[model samples]
Target: MTHTFRPRIAASIAAVAVLGLLAGCTGGTAEETTEQTVTFWTPQATPERLAAQEDIAAAFTEETGIEVEVVAMAGADQDQALVTGAASGDVPDVILHASTQTGAWTSQGLLDTEAAAAVVDTLGQETFNEHAIEAVTLDDQISAVPSDGWTHVIAYRTDLLEQAGVEVPTSVTELAEVATTIKSELGITGLAFGTQAGTASATEGIQSIFQAAGCDLVVDGEVTIDSAECTEAAELFLTLRNSSVAGDFDVTSARAAYMNGDAAMLLFSTHILDELAGLDEATPATCAECVDSPTFLADNTQFVTVLDEENPAQYGAILSYGIPTGANVEGAQQYIEYVMSNGYVDTLGVATEGRIPLRNGMADNPTEFIDAWGALGIGPAHERTSVDLYGEEFVGGMAEGINAVYLWGMGTDDATLAGLVASQGVLAGQIEQLYNGAAAEDVTSAMKAAVEEVQASL
Candidate 1:
């Protein structure tokens, strides 16, 4: 869980990026490198999906004779390695990464925006989901080729909530009440969320709650961590954790808790629906209640995209690929184009449960991929599913949900992102302290100080 890249504490992001450009390449200039081969680093996908990616790359090679080296890197690890590789001037030709990293890395001048834009244009910009394009665009430049997207939601056990006699929560205050009530009535953890210090999950946990409280870590390019709204958000999180959340919550633990029926509610990505429904391979839930219980996919869960509150929004992140400035631009562009075209269906087919296609269509058909994704049949605990578990309404909600994604420092420049990333640990740690019995006032004060520290560092 140790991170190699600490954006919050990065000394000089611009300097690091420039240094990477000047010194990071493995050995020779672009002319000296082999034209037949291009290196690609992919963010970690499921084993099946990873294998599918390799297959797609291989097929691309078969057609074009340009060999692609597919390397899988986990999320945080990729972040660390990319920064390190960039610093050493040894980055891969193309990297598949999260949308959040687009602004940061592009600002560092690590990404070739001109090359990315060309590919997007070649593929036709109108073919993509507008949100996908917006996610990767910064300062009027397309930083990366948008790939897939993930929608965040507050997923809850409908049966359990009903038993606890609580209504579905639509606001931060209402959610807190529901969590407390569920815990007290059911004698189970009411909420599960990642609070692990110094991890991406922790950052996500903090930002999700903070947004619900109507606070942006940065407002109009100014640090607003000390604003009244942010403080209230922190206070609200402290109150919830102290009353109903597990003290040791992290992404893995939180998901496990929900899957095992040990938690009544979980804040998670849309992918959890696949897990809750059970995969086709006959994986069973570890929850004792699941032995003879109804499947969670059987009208036992509720998915919430946006809360009904003053500042309503849900958290989401996009996946994308970009060519580094010093790499094989032609090969990189070709590979990206292939993924968006010839390989599009097969590539997204592997994880249709979670990957909402950013490129919603092809030249001939506007809704081809989107429709295919909607009807993707795979999961099976009892009967197989087609991601239509909750009906077309749920699917439409998710499609709309992608556009509703908002996070702290979103749409801002890289400097603000640096502060946001750096302060993630601070916010996470403070929340954990509250869970461990720290006073709310103290936690809020600490968060304010930590936020200031991150902003100062930037």
Candidate 2:
């Protein structure tokens, strides 16, 4: 993956010259005379991940004769880059990004909804995760092609819970009680989750609680963050945070607390699966017992995929491929189709822990990709499949959960507004206010006002 930005101006100028020559000689379309090249911007920029993407691109090129230039872009910098590219008409042919940006990008006229929908149709919509596809849909059109997604999980130490005589939590109240008991009996942090404001972890952590409690941020283009359910959700989130380690915990610190044996339960994405299993050397398990058994934590951990028995929802984030407005539509579609089909398993194998396959399989074998994904190895060092670490039942449950995962503004008329609200961290900031001892009503009021402000701006 190359970080060096290549302006599309040069390519456009050269393409025009080539078209002129082709018109003068053969009077044929550019597609008939010249090979196509698709520019792909991806945020998965680590060396290992980039190499995997390059290999996938190479394979696609071999099969389709369409060249792909894989560019490495940081996820944080992608928004500004997209804005700049859209303004200059120099955007990449296709972009791999979070589903939260789909509505906003489409509303700004940056993405080509028709092109994305065409790819979805070509690949067979029935093969992809319905919830993921729904998230990227706006105005009855697919804004992007859903790629992969991971759900936030409630991971508890089975040994610690059994020793404390507590059952796994299934509801908000029970979860809080379990955390409290663990803290009192084990003398360890009861729970670990992100509390830092304006971070992805905090935003996602609170949003999961809200979704599980049936709280709505936007409904029919109206700001509905000040409702009773949202207030209750906020209070519940605060209760969990209060039981966590002292001070603010971002994603990294929270994971560390749990892996270091300082916390008994963790609220994080499935990305932690690799680290918890001692498969990633950089973030290896360091629990006291892990010194003797590297996978001690992995063996003793149990994940709660869905909480809040009444509502029954799980928080998840989906990644998608969005073709830009002025891109090589045909070539981009070809590349996406290839990756989602023939190259699907290898592409997802780059980081199996985080990249849950959104596309299950081909139309003929709808469960192929899902089954293969369960067998794909995870972690950077000494890889092992989730099926090997956890059982097939556990892995299958995770696959099923992805189809019903929840996100705040998805599947609503005001999805664009919801995207803007999420991108701006409106609710995340409100979570911080709760952490600072502000009343839940006041926090909800502030959140409602902030969302209204964003809606008004739009």
Candidate 3:
């Protein structure tokens, strides 16, 4: 598969939110120029996203005779390059950026939204999930199509759970009880949390715990993390964090534990399954000793997951192809149009890690992508947990609120806990701040201010 957009490479990044993006609309794009090559930019293409990228690019070349130069940029630095490109008039024909900064990016005119409207009709209102669109939706206009995404789940060692005679909980309370029991009875720490709670692993993956708590980030266009509802969630988060079998979220460390069969439960994304597959057979046996599970949704509450979500929420992202606002508009649009079509996306279904084929019935039966990441049985995956978030509130609450839950559980008082939660937000920007020596205090204070902003807006 060849990418029409510039070539892609996963560049170094502290964290480039892969899913859960909110898109925006801008002035309509221009028509493709007479003859030319289109440039596309993307992070190091993962198997799934890469497969889809190449499928569309190859199709475009075959049909339109346009050659695309794909660029492999680091996830962390893609934004800097993208922003630079947009500013200098050197942006790619299409870009696949993380959804986390989508809102801010759109607000800043970094991306064009009007083009999204041109294709929304063909994409179908139902083509992508609702929240996926909502995240990128601004002022009644959609910026990007909610493409494929992932979700967080409580991956557990099923064999271990059975041996310990402890069943995974469907509810938050049960989840806690199980964690506590695993520790008390077998002297085994039950859950494995990242170094800090709500980091990338938790934010993109385990953050679902908060979602299952019946607390959504946004509710009726209001931010609600500081409210009593999120307070409870905060407490629960702290409790889970303090009780994890391990207290580190470093991907390398977690994988080692998973392979060693030392950790039973992990807050991680569905994609890990594929990553595990790529590992040595001996390494994956530990995961087989375990299984992926989620906080089963209860009978109550309609799920409103984050965009760019890692499952149940299906947070959408754009594996988009774009041309510079004033450059390659036509070519970019044509490239994107071709990729979005059923024919090309359809080809993605069988390319390596077969795509889920976001287009309707295209990948009719679950493809490798769907089989791996689909939220088909989310309700029955793990026990449900109590959540206190809803709607607009979850936005700011996600980064901080989740961390507060972890800190409070770890024994911090209200004031101290609040500061800790605030840190997670700024800490999230660690990747971007990489060039400069980290100023933890300054960053934390800024995060504190941001949290206050969210609270005031709420």
Candidate 4:
């Protein structure tokens, strides 16, 4: 797919057309007609993803007679583009973005919370995942329509664990013990995860463990990273890091280690689902047994969704559709409703492995979309449904876990502040300190101070 960053030229053209219509109309029985088009900005800019979105847009236009001008925005450049567009009153009518940005954008007056709430009401709020809806809500106003999401998981080699006679870990303490035991027994890396400072992968890796430990970075609009829970979480995360492959591990290296059979367990997102099945040619399975059967690792792998037994939670990334303040409200609402209903499955099918359905289905059939999601084909080479690969039982468990996925400050007054602090990699930097032998108490104190500085800057 081609990546293009274009200005809102279509909005300008529409404005000119509207002016022409107004000038030409006189005091007569004249029927002034114009096409309704919703400008949509999406960060899913890959060629394949863009094509899938275009297909959905085309269907929406055919059914509703409302044109959708889909704009591809690179994920890295979307924030800057949104800021500049909002300043010039040239923003798209609708935007598809990560849930992390919804609160911040709404706080900046770039999003229309009332319009979003209207869409939710029109579509029946009960149809959507309650947690997803809550994630994009601020001050009782829905800032965006939840589209899709995925959770982080511990993908482990079931075969190795079975041989070692060790059950899967369910808490931080058990996880560390399992990792240490696996390494000592098997003479291989026990866990593979990112540790690189200032990287999103590293931040997410630690954040998942941190949150699972019942520690909240921000509570009641105050920085709480210095709590006792945070200190214990930090210490446990360092132990996990110590058990991981010794090196500068990032997302790529960690996945590579697992795919190449160098690690027994991998802390990664659900996006690795297809790769585990040896479907992506670029990163095919390279495990020893994979030479004979590329899917050997997949067949021997199992996913652990929740790690904390006492405080069970799963870290996730949610993508949503947001209507901007100056958007064509009517057209945007129609489009969002259609995408969440008739076109919902196709939208999620863009990348089934990562796009878990947030809106379950119509009120009549709550599991309609959830069931379809499990059956959606995945992988670039030989497509196969997740249900076909992992079975229905596992897929259902994942869907259930997604309903209560956790993020640092989602659904809170300080969500924007928390997002800013997370983006700055404060937690990851503090994690690096832990890796370097800093006391957990000291690291937690530094994390609290850094988060406070970020909050003050806002």
Give the higher-lDDT candidate: 2 or 3: 2
Model 3 residue 59 lDDT score: 59
Q: State TM-scores per candidate.
A: 0.79, 0.88, 0.63, 0.91
Candidate 4 Cα lDDT to native: 0.79
The full ranking of all candidates by TM-score, starting with the best, is: 4, 2, 1, 3
State in Å the error of residue 266, model 1. Answer: 1.4
What C-alpha RMSD separates each model from the true structure? 8.5, 6.2, 12.2, 5.8
Highest-scoring model, TM-score: 4
Model 1 is weakest, by summed lDDT over 10 consecutive residues, at: 1-10
Q: What lDDT is reached at residue 297 by model 4?
A: 84
The lDDT of each candidate is 0.69, 0.79, 0.44, 0.79
- Candidate 4, residue 234: Cα displacement in angstroms equals 1.0
- Rank by lDDT, descending? 4, 2, 1, 3
- Judging by lDDT, tell me the better candidate of 2 and 4: 4
CA RMSD (A), model 1: 8.5
Q: lDDT at 450 for candidate 4? A: 86
Clashes per candidate (backbone, < 3 Å): 7, 0, 87, 1
Candidate 3: what lDDT? 0.44
lDDT tens digits, residue span 221-325, model 1 = 565665777777777776566444457577888888888888888888877766776554443566776567646543577777777434556677778888886
